[model samples]
Target chain A: MSNLAGWGHYPIVATECLPERGPVDIAGLVSAHPSMIARGHGRAYGDAAIGQPFTLPTLGLNRLRSFDAATGLLRVEAGVSIAEVLATFVPRGYFLAVVPGTKFVTVGGAIAADVHGKNHHRDGGFADSVEAFRLVTPGAETVTCSRTVNKELFAATTGGMGLTGVIVEATLRLRAIETGWLKQQTHIAADLDAAIAALEATAASTYSVAWIDCLARGNALGRSLIYAAEHASAQEFELLSNGRTAFPPARSARLAPPLVAPSWLLNRASVGAFNALYFGRGVARAGAPELVHWDTYFFPLDAIGHWNRIYGRRGFVQHQCVIPLETARGVLAEILDRVARRGSVSFLAVLKQLGPSHGLMSFPMRGYTLAMDFPMTDTLLPFLDEIDALVADAGGRLYLAKDARQSRATFEAGYPGLAAFRELRCHTGADRHFASHLSARLGI
Target chain B: MSDQKTVLILGGSSDIGYATALRYAEGGWRVWLAARDLASAQRNADDVTARSGQPVTVHALDVLQSEKFVDFVAQMPALPDTVISVIGELGDQKRAETDSSYAAMIMRTNFEAPSQLLDIFAGRFQARGTGTIVGVSSVAGDRGRGSNYFYGAAKAGFSQYLSGLRNRMSLAGKVRVVTVKPGFVRTRMTAHLKLPASLTVTPDRVASDIYGAAEENGREVIYVAKRFWLVMTIICLLPEPLFKRLKL
Candidate 1:
């Protein structure tokens, strides 16, 4: 349920794990269902955590089997949540080094997807922080893999997106922290160039990202909210909220009318109004370093649970593409120009800097990636293709992990690693059970 | 990704293929711009790098020489994510009708060559249990409008091939397949057509949506201007007797 995306609605199968306090028989389950799609807390934004026929639920498998608090080392089953890790150890002054957008994700999912965050520009993808993990391949064989052990599988499986096998247990590195709070600063950029400059200037100063207004045409084509932050000291965190038990309240969803409404109901007229409402709600000031909690700073959307329902029933498509930073300005301009030309209205768009990825099949490159969402519509393909070509000309690559409709030709042309990744798949003679609808659609 | 995750677009000089090459190059994988004219592929590669800041290599490829495709794949550091078939419609339907050679040329480029290259790509992708295949099939294939069904019929055959290839690849794992069914795209291919404002969509918009469908979601059959989906659906589902009676 947590991994559902706007592309399609599908049933979620549960994963299996031994509860920390359970008298469970691991051997029995392992023998019964040797081949399974292992999942953690199922917090993946896309299909990274779910499988169709058989899923190995790992949330209940929560248990920090071992931890050397002194050395910043932690050994946990694949199901341990980032929140749980922070709650259990942060009090004692330690934290997970690299966290994705949501702490709800499991330790295993993080390693499998090699998730990246705003700090990725400096820290690299999550795979950079991983110590090692236990993987159950499709052949029902379990092996511990790392940079040196089963190296090809290790590299491929890092960002392999669960295609290589299922992750059962993992040992991840922990970040020593003074508090669970973050020192955050937000700045507003006038346009795409200014926004990109702001991102570049502060990139080395701190973790950076910008929330762009995709529908902004002409001068404000890529207006953005640039944010940078570092972990706040424990004393500062304590003083900011006066040690409140919970985080900030979330913005409730203004639910739509209904599903299956006529597609015309969400046309440019409605979208234009929506865009105005979105853009007019921003703050003009900048430079105040607000003290914030881990959840608020990192997983802001998680607070507003089930936000996808806001799109109604047609669901939506998350279109994200990475263009080389050099051509980002021109490519983005052309893309936005085209979007405006086509009158495709989108409420919010985010543009961020992506450094080279460290994982084998990692998505981010040394470029700028922009993600925009629009309700599924009839004109989606041609409109999307126009931008697709722009990004391609800019030497951009699309992220496979998040794609729903990119064609096989575009993907093959976009990701040269597809064949290499496929080559690795050839060696592993497991059933084709590791595939996904996206993979099937793209012929991957 | 030792397979180079590299793409060598055959139509490097053309708009669609060139755009796709840049997209891949920017995403971090190396790109090989393969065009009939090696110089154009190189210039496109240089321009791609200038825009993307990622390295793009250029190669000489001739789809007409099907025998060279195997050799091309053999020399490639890796097989491409896909080989786009965006080279067609040079031979006008009316002209092709008057000249059999012109008609044969369109068929060879639109269907025969794509079939050859995909056969090679599909075999490799199937064995590996992972690969994506996309072919830009036009909405013209929806029905032989007195306008251009020769090219349309060729795209129709290519779309069918994609489905069959996808079925075969699914046995290994699954081959992601997307056959873009675009309406009157405003490209040089349809430059002469007095395209209706309502039916035409720009290249970037098509590229954006196609990129979305191909990379993010993997929608199997995407009508670029989604309205074309409805338009085509009605057209496909129209009463056959009544439709033929009107000479549409």
Candidate 2:
């Protein structure tokens, strides 16, 4: 037995972690344990990947089954992380169609969360690039799911929070890239409305995301640096690489922060100062279009290993919610105001526009999503509950992958697809065998 | 045929073997993964191939079956530039202490089988006039401990065999032999043991040490994480009476 927690390190649970090796007999394991959840890299920010009793760590199952260079399709075991994929295929001119902020997350976790990238507004969620996946059902039968085969199960499993079954393998359709470089154009926004407008205006770009200053107040409230990027052409890469077109040198060495930061290190005052300096830098470099490495553009935080430790031993909770386009501007402003008023410290704040998602329980919709992390404290949950009420009133939903604490009522209010999802789980007996802290907390 | 360097890894299904295969593959070597479990070896081979964009061939060779050693070497596509033997059995010390059959199995697996297999490869490489051989031993082999002396004794024999092999290969000055002593590796084999954070190193760390040894000539022995060399030195120099008093 080992103590485990999601990426956020909040709500750590003691569970028997069975680190699976090679090919796993899913049926045998399922029958052996009363209940278990599949945990892949534990990159989900909250309790989605953790549960009581047993946690089947899929790290050992990592293997690339096959790759079709001609079609740019790769089949790999669920534990295969995006970092591994990038390391393997980027040099071959292939890249994942959709990638989350961190490349350390496993393909299984990506599908389970129905993760979206900065390109979500243009390319949709990770499910969009998924061709098919092999799921080990709660009944222990391995079933292949695709849009056409096991269609309903496929819909429910993607973004289903791993409750539908254990995703053992997946076939993903990768995009061909000329070079692993992005022509990024940064636009500095003065306030909430301007930031939203900038993101909306850059909708044509293949990728767009904004880093907001959560501590900014009054006229500068929601001030952000919006980055809009498109894959750099071969010619552009040649100019940068002295006529040699190659993927940016394999991921640079990452610096690991101390195991845990003191709780008071990241207080509101410190975060406010950091945000001010960052916003100033963004303003200075605003409008300059530079060819940056994919890692720099998409996964900046990944450069700092164990970055979560900066949040302190108390850990942190990420409140990520998406509001419909119509009410996004107002809700975003109100959220920024509430967070600022509370004087809570959030070191990282990101906002991205999302296109319509297909998965039954997918978090993305045709809306604007704001994600901010707050240090977990006695008052944090109750404070977030109030934010949830506000979001619920505006027909907004919180992302299950990032949710550590939220009232079941608020969850039900946001996800209307819950009824269909629960019905399928009931029919498949997944609800009984496959359960997680997130599922039980949300009463799904 | 391309002049790509080739490496054959015995016990390819083991975590250290698989990691070494990947490390060699990534360094532009065509990897051959041979193990008793062909299915598991093939799966790992596929992963290495995919990751390195190099073709990895898988073969079945049960180390305990000494009769098949000659056939296993002959069956390979070509003589490899390097051969890494990562085969070892960490049999339960308590069980082996009483059961002669179990104790003999541990002894044969950790020492006799691997040494015999390498001896065959050494003869082949001698004829070809170029090759590198790596044997993965352990820090436990430096000195016997009551807790796991049965398994440790076998590894100690294996380590001595590697030392003797290195001396023989040095006479020819064409072939190189490396013995790797990894301390507290965080592998499935040691998952049950509560290893110290400072001492425990990942299989990848051990793999890199093997790679370094193979690439550099005259590197007869290496301790993974490097600090294990100093650690084992002190442990070996300890006064027996005092060393025996403390439970390791």
Candidate 3:
């Protein structure tokens, strides 16, 4: 509600008390009310976590009742945040092996979305880390699913959009960390080709990613800075001064003027000028020694706070596509060239090196992932249609989480395992009512 | 168009209402852009679908046509998860002097018909324990002004109704109630009005913000340009005697 930004502000039904503190009978409450959506952390940008009738904020379900430090096993309530897990367990020399960009996400939400991170090429998604979970379905039946028991439900719940059941608690594996530092090397590529070359050459390392300048065109269409890291030992951390709170803390909750600018203000001319300044400001930047802290290295966007407002009132869409390694160079070059020609103003564009897919419903493959922000506008639909065709032609697909305006037709056309997902939804036979609340346009 | 989520817009083709249709279509949501006039709503639907490359269906959903509402609700392939009422008229305070009819129409447009539709949906929402409802009020409802108290009164009444609806739905599961109180919006409705830089908000910005809020339940009663919140704060803090005398 800050400024005149046109955002939908629904009345959040406040459950000031925890689920345990409240009724203590989840089945009774759900049976009495069928339209409830189990929400975790309120982090989902769209409606996957929200349904038509209710949003069940499950972040409050957090409780770490059991942890077997010897086995590297922990059973936690679905609401417990990943940060809390690390805070409690890291001192015991354990952490989530596979984590997304932000530590603010809850374990349940992470599992439901099957979220991945920069280390995805090495570790895969959160589902890979989990062992078992207690699931409560719409029929008010609670079932514990694991690799052995209810195996189909276990796989279905992973990236299942919370349609099948509600997660109460789960057991997951944790990795041992030393000195909380990454033995890292940074390579600065002068142009797109060099960046691609650098990543391709070094992605075999335990940890690897590339941040490319998406606005760069022509000879520099894919200029990038690459980082490959390994878990640092105490000696390496000491040698490089790599451990603990290294970066200057960013200012959070800094109030910016929330004024609505005329539509002309964000048109191509102004955006082009901004792009010119941004693209010109950088050429090739290099190494920053052994990096530390999970926060700074991964979730840089989370540091900025409500960063989406930077696109102003019309908000922005994050479009990500991954083209296979065989076509990565061509697809990336063409995409950047088109963006430059269109004078697209995206302050943040991320490029990551991906590896082969793990299984069914997996988003990653041995390819290059390029993510760029585009201001939501009247022209965006057609513009994206052009981009989608190009990505499709290049054997690439879009990410579902960040999507706002894609048709189900487009999604089915793009994503490889979409048919399998549809069949799963069919077999589940639950009244499919997933809220995108973003736009009623998706044919879901 | 026929496959669209049927929306029964009471006012139908009002600027903000039509703008909402565009927002719906842009997101690939098939829209039933209902208006008082079937032709006007259909035309607006055509315009929105053509522009957004999404589907739009038109329906006659006149507040005056209350008897049709039940049949309308039952006829839908599914009960809509959302309903938006963007009906308002900044009735001149001077008109209240000569005619109660104009004032009543403004009141009913701003408050009554919306309340009736909401009463129906609220029951459905409570019965189902889910659904979202949106009522577009104005910053005019924040504090009554000497300039437009007649219209402001209606909006204020509508705002309170939404607040009550929100309270009722709070325990009724996830029946979301959104009360939009935008400030100076640059739509056809305000074509002739003078607006401050901080007050004016674009249709696209409004649509996107509203879409984001609805998508995420970020806020209720979102002021289009967040600056309006501060502006309203300053206005709210003004001394009573001094505020009443202002030409503004």
Task: Name the best candidate (by TM-score).
Answer: 2
Full candidate order by TM-score, most accurate first: 2, 3, 1
lDDT per residue (tens digit) for residues A1-444 in model 1:
334332233222233332221113333444455344555654444454445434555554444555665677776667778777765666666767777766667777787777778887888888887888887676666788888888888888887777777666677777887766777888888888899898898788447778876667788877778878888765666666565643233323344344455545666788778766655554533666777667667777667555555555665666788898788888887876777677776655777788887666778889888877677677777788777877777778777555666766666767767777887776675336465444445665
TM-score of each: 0.56, 0.95, 0.57
Q: Chain A of candidate 1 scores what in TM-score?
A: 0.84
Cα lDDT for residue B105, candidate 3: 78
Weakest 10 consecutive residues, lDDT, candidate 1 chain A? A15-24
Local accuracy of candidate 3 as per-residue lDDT tens digits, A1-444: 111111111212222222331113555555555555566666654445544554556754545545665777777778888877766555555668787766778898888777777777777778888899987766677789888998877877776656566777788988877655567777877787887888777767767777766556777676666777776766676677733532223224344436544445665657556655544443222455555455556565666555555665566677778888899888888888888777676656778777665334556677888888777777776888888888888778776555655556666666666556556655754335333232233533
Better of 2 and 3 by DockQ: 2
Evaluate model 3: give its TM-score: 0.57
- State which candidate, 2 or 3, has the greater TM-score: 2
What digit string (tens of lDDT, one per residue) describes model 3 on residues B128-151?
876778888888888888887778
Q: What is the lDDT of residue A60 in candidate 1?
A: 44
True contacts kept of 1: 0.00
Q: After superposition, how far is residue A155 of candidate 2 from its true place, in Å?
A: 1.1
Name model 1 segments beyond 4 Å from true: A1-36, A39-56, A234-282, A430-433, B1-248
Cα RMSD (angstroms) for every candidate in the order listed = 25.2, 2.2, 19.4
Candidate 2 local lDDT, A20-121, one digit each (tens): 755566667876775778998898988888865678778877889889888988999999999989888888888899999999999999999999999999
